[model samples]
Each structure stands twice: as C-alpha cells, then as structure tokens.
Target: MSTGPGILAPVTALGAATLRLLGEMGAMFLFLADGLRLIFASPKQIPKILNQVFVIGSKSLFVILLIGVFTGMVLGLQGYYTLVKFGSEGLLGAAVALSLIRELGPVLTAIMVTGRAGSSMAAEIGVMRITDQIDALDVMDINPMAYLVSPRIAASLISFPLLTAVFDVVGILGGYVTGVTLLGINEGVYFYRIQTSVEMADITGGFMKSLLFAVIVATVSCYQGYFTHMRRDGVGPEGVSNSTTSAVVLSCVFVLVADYALTSFLL
Candidate 1:
C-alpha cells in the first residue's frame, strides 16, 4: 500500500526536476548572452576567433566528406529504387538534390561538427577548468568568457554554415555519380530537373537552420565545460568526460528538435 509521504514523493521529485530544468535554461540563456556580448567587446579577439574558425571549420572537412559522400550515395541508391517502382526514376536527380539542399546537408553537417568540434571544445574547456587554468586567468584579472568562450561561439556560428555549404556541394556530386554513372539514369534530365525544382528559398532556409544549430551546439558545449565540477573539490578527467558526453548528446537532441520546428515553420 502507498503511504501519504510515498505518494507525495513522486510529485515532489517531478517538481524538483522541472525546477532544475527551468533554472538551467535560464542560466544558459544568460551565459549565451554574456558570451555574445564578450565577442564584440573591445579588442575584438579577432585573431583567436579566426584561428578557432579555421580549427573548428577546416579540421572537420575530411569527416564531412566521408559522411556527405556516403549519405548522398545512399540517398541516391534508395531514392532511385523507390522511384523506379513507379517508373518515375526520372525524378531521382530532383529528389536527391532537394533532400541534400533542403534538409540533410545542413542537419548532418551540424551533427557531424557537433560530434567533432563540439566535443573537442567541451573537452578542452573541461580540462582547463579541472587543471585550474581558468582560475589562473581570473587571478590575472582576465575575463575568461572573452578570452576563452566567445571566440569558440563565434567560430561555430561562422564555420557551421560554410562547412554546410561544402557538404551540400559534395553531397550533390556524390548523388550525381550514383544516379548517373552507377544507376544509368539520364544525366541531362537529372541536372535539368534539379535546376528547375530547387529554389533559393530552400538553400537559404537550410542555411538559417544551420546557423541556429551552431548557436545551440556552441552554447551547450561551452556551458558543459564552464560548469562541470571535479570530484574532490573541482573537476577531474571523469568529470570532463561526462560533461563532454552530455554536451554532445544535448546538442544533438536540440539540433533535431530545432530542425523539426524550423522545417515545420519554414517549409
């Protein structure tokens, strides 16, 4: 039999969880705003921002290529088979192009960067926090957010869209190879239909989504690192690892949720 306290325990737990979630959300909002402000404050951190952009954006190119190629090839192969069943295999080019430009390209590129650059950002910051490096900055009277966090956030915002564009181009090329060379589709029809079907709206909308996703990823990653605590009195390696995992998972979930919401509203 359930006692009164026992019954109340579940409700209490739920309330606590909800409060915690709201609190975290509020804190994260403030943190993100602070980071953004720090980005454009005096001295601009231009050098660091550019370096982070290169590291975060350029370093992920090979991984993007590998995934983008395979994803496009698979989309081509599967889309062709499905369309062929209705003798509309002629639409393969349009379908693949639409899929990449309108949705897959930006979403997958952000997810890939989340896994690669996002995790790295969290881990790097986590290590600094655990090692007392952040404290050292504070001791020197330096604002850590300006020096440490702002550049990363700005870099992500810039890198994600650029990387997504490359992913789109490469993905289209892969689809071309699969649909035309491998599947023996009519090449001229493919290009012509895609050129006609895909519009500027689709490309621009996807880029907008990528920009929003970048903010989510960078904010979550920086938050995880900046707040993660060590076991003894501060953070340890295990804490860093856990924070990194949390950042990546949360960023991915937020990306998907945002993607759905944006697609519904925009498309």
Candidate 2:
C-alpha cells in the first residue's frame, strides 16, 4: 500500500551516501594537494622529512624482509610444481621474479607499510586533533598541514620505492633459495631466465605503482586523522580509534584499487 515511501527511503539513503562519499573524496584530494604544495615551505622541514623516512621506512624494514622471503619461497614452490607438469621448471625463476618485481613487490610493500605507518599517522594526528595540539599550532601560525602532513607525504614518496626495491631483491633471493638450492633446479637457468625475461619497463612500472600508492596511503591516512574530530560516528578517544581503523582499511582498499588501475594502464 505504501511501496512508494519504502522505495524512496532506500533510494534517498543511497543518494545521500553517494554524495557524502563524493564530498569526502573531493576534500581528501584538496588535502593532498595542500600537503604536497607545502612540502618544501621551509628548509627546516628537512629534518622532519628525514625523521618520517626513518619512521616509515627503516622501521618497517624487518617485517618487509620477513614477508618478502616467505612470499618468494611460496612462489618458487608453487611455480616449480606447476611448471614441472609441462617440463618447464626452468621458467620458475622468470615467473617468480616477474611476479615479485612487476606486481607483488610494490603492492605488498605498500600494504605492509600502510599497516605499520599509515595507522600510526592517523592515530597520532587524531590524538593531536582531539587534544587541541593542532589548534595550538594554528594559533602559533605554524601551519599544521606543513608541519605534520607534508613531511609524511614526502617521506612516503621516498620510502615506498626503496622498500619495494628491497622487497623485490629479497623475494628473488628467496625464490632462488627454494627453486635452485632446495628444489635442485639449475641455478644458471633460474637467474638467466629472470635476467632475460624481466625488462626495464617492468621495473619502472612497479616503481610508478609504489609512488602512486605512497601518495594514496599518505594522503588518506593524514586526512582521516586530521578530520577525526568531525566524524559523526565518534569523538575524542573513540574518534581517534575510528580514524585509525578507517585510515588503514581505506589505505589498503585504495592501494589495491590503484594497483589494478595501474596494471591495466601499464600492461
């Protein structure tokens, strides 16, 4: 009898949600532009940027190594068995190297760093917002965006590529250990295939993905934290927690989505 109102209710909710998402996305892009624009506003920012690099890059090194090795080993094991069916186990090296360098290296590095550093960014900024520390910086004309967000953005840009390189190298070695040393595949063939099959284009494409992911993770993480106080779902400590959770989740989702988009273009 009242189907009109029922249907309209769901439609209105969906429309409102879509509008809100679009608004938030617009705001986030502006936030990223502003943060990047102010990255070099002062020479004194050098130390801050370096500090963030250490935080986001050096600190995450061990986890990246551990994950990279295991992933490569798994790839080697699987690729060997799969290729052996066709008597092409020698291609294992090429398969693992290409997979890690062109895809997994950038994607996994970004996701891991996002988990470690992105969440921290959101939590730290969210805490600052809730505690009025950000306000104090504004009162002092310190430019909170420049002071807090820009360094992080700069650091992510620096860190993501380097970490991806490390992941690729370590993953290749791991694959070597499994495919050649343990699996008894020809070491020369393994390395030769990797060298011959992987091109400069693939390497550059992976770096490009890392750079884009760096921007996405940094901007989304900082934006979530900066606007924590404005969240409708929570406030104060709860708001900080929600912001941190949202930052990690959104960064990962954005990373994967960006990865697919980049792959399509690069391929």
Candidate 3:
C-alpha cells in the first residue's frame, strides 16, 4: 500500500529540517576552523585581538563581579543553614569554594559574557552582512574572517580564563562576607577549609570549562551573525535581531551542555 501525501509531508519536512541542521553544523565547523586559522596568520592582528579583549573582557567586568559576589553570598547563606542542620556549618567554606571554583564561577561567567558580548558580536556582524559591508571587505581584498572573526576568537581564548578567575575570586570573597561576617562562622576556619579542600585540579577544571565556553560563545555568535543574510526567518534588521537572539540562546545552551560533558570528564 502506498503512503498518503499527508503521511509523506511530515516525513519530508522532518528530513529537510534534519538536513538543514546538519548543514548548518558543518558550516559552523568550517567557519570556526577558518577563523582559528587566520587568528595567528599575521602579527597585525594583535591590536585587533587586544581591542576585542577590551570589548569582551573589560566591558564585562562589572557585571561579572556583581553576579559573582551575589551568587557566592547566596550560596553561603544557604550552605550555612543547610550545614547547621547537620552540625557541619564549619564546612561551609569548602562547600562554597568547591561549588564556585568547580562549576558556578565558570558557567555563570560564560553565560554573562554571552548575554553581553555575544549579542553584540552577532548584531554587529549581522548588520555588516545585511549592509553588504562584508562584501565591501571582499572587494577590498581583505580577509573578512581574519579582519572580523579571528580577533574575537583569539580574544575570547585569552579573556575567558581571566574573567573566570575574577569571578571565582570575587565570589569567594562574597562567601566570606556572608559566612564569616554575617553568619558568624569563624574567619580562620573558612579560609582554612578553603585552602585545604580546594586543589589545583579543581581550579584547572574550572578554567578549562571557561575556555570551552568562550569558544562556544564566540563561534556561535559569529557564525549566526556572519550568515544573517541567509536566514529564512527574516532579513535586514529583523534578521539581525533574530540572529542576536539565537546567538545568546544557543551560546547559553551550549555552555550548559558543554559544562555537563566537561564535568563528567573532569570528575
């Protein structure tokens, strides 16, 4: 018996969607590869990379510090109460430190950067794409990937770890404020537990996650913006808007997924 058109239509659509997803993934991989290849091809890119570091890193500092501190404070409060129930309040430092250094610090930092700088990267590139500025670069014999994408990628590689370190340090201080200053946990005990419980491995793992998140955010944002002109959802300004939204959403999702995978491996 032959299948009806009704049955075939859904299958066809599903197939098309799958193919499109695969194609996009392939294109993204190539885009990242090309960008990475160009990142160190010329010494002149150092200035551009430094500029992006400022854009993606320095511009993001205040927000990261704010979030990190609040996150640590919350963790300290909750952990203190929870540990108190078990007569283990002294371990609060270890708990807070481990959580921040191993997970929250890197993850939150990445998400924040995605929300701030990732959106900017997408919108800027999408605008350029829509306005034919990318084409203008081509006509000028400039490598758009180098001139536009690589510096951002290189900057991300440098900036993420630094930002994550800042987040971790600030967060730890926040925890200390809540646990020691507010909750009456012994100050010496807090620092002692942290020093004893946190190892180099934990710090390294967090940095690794931050680095991975940086690449994910940069690549996804750039790829979406770079191809905004080809989006089926919209075009021109609307396309840029859609691309920016998608860039932030995808970057966050990928960060979480990568975190899980990395955590499993690191564990």
C-alpha positional error of residue 23 in candidate 2 after TM-score superposition, expressed in Å: 0.3
The lDDT for every candidate, in the order shown, is: 0.91, 0.96, 0.96
Q: Residue 214 in candidate 2 has what lDDT?
A: 97
Best prediction by lDDT: 2
**Model 2: residue 78 alpha-carbon error in angstroms:** 0.7
What lDDT does model 1 reach?
A: 0.91
Clash number for every model? 2, 0, 0
- Candidate 3: where is the Cα deviation over 4 Å? none
Residue 2 Cα positional deviation in candidate 1, in Å, after optimal superposition = 12
**Per-residue lDDT for 197-267 in model 1, tens only?**
99999999989998999999999999999887732333598889889999999999999999999999996
Note the residue pairs that clash in candidate 3: none
Error of 3 at 37 (Å): 0.5
